[model samples]
Target: MTMSLGPYASFIVTSYAAAAIVVAILIGWVVLDYRNQARRLRELDRSGVTRRSGRSAVDTP
Candidate 1:
């Protein structure tokens, strides 16, 4: 059997691909961020991070 696209099939395919790529990127970002946050939380728990006032990372004038 021969399958055929009536019209705009190429556009539909591209759109689907783009949507999938976007979702994949978003999922990856979320996973990475969750991992980073978990690591930070672990470190904070180990070190007992407190809310002490100190010089910030960068010098601000």
Candidate 2:
């Protein structure tokens, strides 16, 4: 089946295409960032580094 966009076809089609591309780019960036962060955390862990929090486990008690 053939789909047709009436008078504002170009505008509508271009808008949808642009939106799709933007969403794809955003998803790719998030995945890349997550991988990089995970790798950095692993390296830090290997070097015996620990994360500190303002509220300590001992303080909680």
TM values, all candidates: 0.71, 0.81
Worst ten in a row by lDDT for model 1: 51-60
Superposed Cα deviation of residue 41, candidate 1 (Å): 0.3
TM-score of 1: 0.71
Q: What is the lDDT of residue 53 in candidate 1?
A: 52
Candidate 2 vs. true structure, TM-score = 0.81
* Predicted structure 2: lDDT: 0.94
lDDT of 1 by residue, 1-61 (tens): 9767669889888999999999999999999999999999799879988544555657445
Model 2 misplaced regions, further than 4 Å: 1-3, 54-61
